[model samples]
Target: MTVKEVKKGNACALLPLIIFVALFIGAGVLTKDFSNMPLNVAVIIASAVALLMNRKEKFEIKVSIFTKGAGHPNIMLMAIIFILAGAFATVAKGMGAVDSTVNLGLSLLPANLLMVGLFAIGCFISISMGTSMGTVVALAPIGIGIASQTDIPVALTMATVIGGAMFGDNLSMISDTTIAAVRTQHTKMKDKFKVNFFIVLPGAILTAIILGVITRGNKAVIGADFHYELIKILPYIAVLAAALAGVHVLIVLIGGTIFAGGVGLADGSYSFGSFLKTIGEGLMSMEDLAIIALLIGGLVEVIRHNGGIDYLLYTVNSKIKSKKGAEFGIAGLVSAAAIATANNTISIVVTGPLAKSIADEYEIDPRKSASLLDTFAGSWQGILPYGGQMLAAAGLAAISPVSIIPYSFYPILMGGCAILAILNGYPKLGTKSKEVKQVATVPVEE
Candidate 1:
């Protein structure tokens, strides 16, 4: 009458991603479409399974764990950004601001260089804004218009925007990933950026060339009579200026919403009542993302509590045999966490404590570790089908998030540079830096 089997607790930690993929298959069967269904529902279902896994634990403990994850500061911050971004975007689109802005951009740039221009613009905006989500919000809609009026694929354009955003977000001094990495590793931000910038420069250049080639043969289909109003394009300009001025993102979006609303009223794009309606509609559009983010936050907490994080660390750290090996270990650990959490900042934060320990053990420079944490996490997150950046871009483009991964050129190249940095130990810290004393050790028998 007694059970003899023991559960593999850590293995169960992967239940969420497993269930999410299964839901895609199930959706394909039920609805004949795998990409556009309710992905948040998959997270919800996985959450339930996570709660039920450890029956020996108190129910209150399980609820508390779920609640803490759902209420994490980072997750809450992202939810708020989503709501504000939606409101700004909706009000702008409802006011014809999007069309006017597109017209201006199309008129100013030639067809052959439009994709390159978008990528370059995305890099500048993301660096200024210090938030890839903010960058994507500002540019993806314009990319959509460019795609519609040209021969380029919507997915490729979306991918280009995201790739550029990641490039800047990884190196921006004000970015959350950069801030988290520097603070966790106790290094100066400027120092980290110097090393980080050099590592990513080659990748950025290569990505630009690739975009230019892919877009060269494409022609603009816009007619000579295409028109736009300069007055209506102020909203995007205002957003970009405020971001460049170092304004906080929350204020940027709130101010953008109000400014866009004022413009809408002045131009009679929408009546006051319809303006309110547009705001409501905008909030509704991002609800799925907010819900999914909360579920993922909670699900990741459950996985960590069940030893999933430790298992990854052990799996990677066990392979270290030298200083260089330790550097790669940090990369692999952070990369794995990014794939699991689908968030770059959270991945760096969760893995930082152990990474610092590894850096100390091997005497690897803090600057290097900080750069590695941000680089590796960013490279992985930029391509994750479930990450916020991909979801936001795809939602704006009316396409599946998975569709953009094939064109994530910058992220793919950034990873290559990171690997090379590890191998070559570029920017080698002088031997004058602290080094651990060699102590004789005894091997333990298994």
Candidate 2:
């Protein structure tokens, strides 16, 4: 390619990404309804814009780029997981798992201890499963159900779930963000986990304390009669144990559905036909989100084809002059990519290669860099009201997604602490290895 052609091509990459942000964020603001505009529609418009911007390329080449984006391994893996999760969640709920779980949970705790316990559970489940969405899906309804029984606001309960989920999502070794960051930055997972744990540890503790204090006033103890039979609680426990076992999340969810169905039918809680109905309901419940997922996949493909990612990378790298700036760049890159994509794992994957290159140039510690990428992306994912995790939490709680934004202390603090630690050199990047010379060349934001 000629010099001018290459420059133009690289700059063209950002077009779809711009369109996506404008449409998605814009629609949400203009309509004053988070779901007023379908995510798929916004993605479709942006993708078309991306394709149009790359008109200079051969149609076949353009198609190839789009295909590559859609077929990216990370994207495909997430999609499959979404499908299975949908099926499992629907079946479990239909078969009375959600109700049973909720009633059982409520009956087991004092009202004063409800909020903190819910948050703690959210944290534990997400940490074990390495997924915020999975945790939110499994726990948000329970939180909401608890709220309805008491006088607690559902939105507050929803925020509790979101906060706890983010704590684990940011630090969990099995998280997609962690994998993407580690692979891209060439770091050990255990090392990154250590760096991240310290940064977010205080935030998690503080949030839990705050929630505990807030709920402490309501001290009513739940009665045993309100609890479901112990058998009914098997599905959730099984799912949690399986996730902790490092079983693939898809399998864990499927297993939960089977266990729930078997126990439900055997206990006369549900008929076989109802069990199938429950499964179908769960699968169908995720239909809207599934469409949104596919649209995001296709939209990102167009953005990648049009050079949007490269454009951002080039601009960001040109201005980095120090270790602090490099750290900030890494955080900002992953944060921006995640907000645009609404998927932490994909965000890390998209930003990882470039972040890796930056780390190499700055002689920054690979482990620190990896931790920053994962922590920031996961943090951003938590705060983004439109993101799948928050959306799922909001939907399950029957609350507005934005309602959880201000109160999501864990994610917000994680982002702040990660940036602060980088600036202060708290983790001491040189501890692991000699500093590699920096290679970054992106324009610095003024």
Candidate 3:
């Protein structure tokens, strides 16, 4: 199809996405139970609508488009990461790593500092690992354990993990969202990190102070008598080490899983049969996420084929009136994509090319564009009740994800800073920067 033909189909093709959103959100609102409507079901209905919209295409052609979307390299790679993460998580839990790590961290912090410490540790781990989900999974249980022993509210404790996870997610070089943004905008990761850090750091500090006050007089006794086998912690250590070495995230997760299995076997926590079983269990645990990922891939593929993304790019870019307006547009684009995808990395992937195009058209710095992508995506992911980061943390803490949204300091701060920076043009694109000319035109790369 010609570009004009593609453009003509964009709006019509995108109607299914509107339908999906309305059905899913409306259903959830009416039922007051988001889970009442299965995520995959919503995607399936959306996909059907997309199929029906392509009236001129043969069934085979439409199926081919769907296949292309489901098989995108980035989507496949994420599936691998999810599988490995599941395996590592299960093996680590079986080895008592979770308990040990929780106790270890709790014992180290002063009673009065538990709230601050949780936030700090969450941030540290996410920054180290470059994954908000990983950070929340590692720390939320500890927050729950602490809450059980202390007078602190479980929801508040959960919010600490949420806040800290977003703090690191927004600034970490290894984060998938960061990687997607930098790659898409053709900017250096270090440059983006510098901009992101300054914007989120103050909010983190203020959050620490606020949490400290709220949790005052709720000190819990952190016992030190528990025995911990250092070997059990190898999975997390290996994951962190690989991420620090700048390994690809999928490979790092797979390596961690292998390490965790070896440790589990060495500790006699699993026999060969049980080790294999653990892998199966781990894979099974990720079934929900895997399905969600595939459905989203297929659904978005339909949307892309119909021109939804192109329509967005055309409409959003054409309205840019100034540098500040362009920046706000970029932020809104990334935020909208993140809300749709519910995964920051995927959101960046979906929006990054368009953002680069807008940045180039407006003479915005690639680094600034990348920073906006990370900042906005991280902000939305952090506070979104249905987003994976909050869901993972809430699940671990046994709290409502929405309960943490209002108190998530880093996300709220990031959003505010992003808006302020855009308005003030604080990180102005350097005229001498090579990327100012290089990143103006962005096309979806297969």
* Model 1 misplaced stretches (Cα beyond 4 Å): 1-33, 111-115, 118-201, 211-226, 320-411, 417-446
Better of 1 and 2 by TM-score: 2
In order, what lDDT does every prediction score? 0.75, 0.68, 0.71
Q: What digit string (tens of lDDT, one per residue) describes model 2 on residues 120-211?
A: 77776666555677668778767776777788788888888887778877766445566556555655555667777887787788887887
What is the C-alpha local distance difference test score of candidate 3?
A: 0.71
Ranking by lDDT: 1, 3, 2
Q: Which is the winner by TM-score between candidate 1 and candidate 3? A: 3
Arranged by TM-score with the best first, the candidates are 3, 2, 1
Better of 1 and 3 by lDDT: 1
Best-performing candidate as measured by lDDT: 1
In model 2, how many backbone clashes occur?
A: 21
User: What C-alpha lDDT, on a 0 to 100 scale, does residue 317 get in candidate 3?
Assistant: 55
| Candidate 3 root-mean-square deviation in Å | 5.1
- Distance from true location, Cα of 3 in model 3, Å: 12
Predicted structure 1, TM vs. truth? 0.64
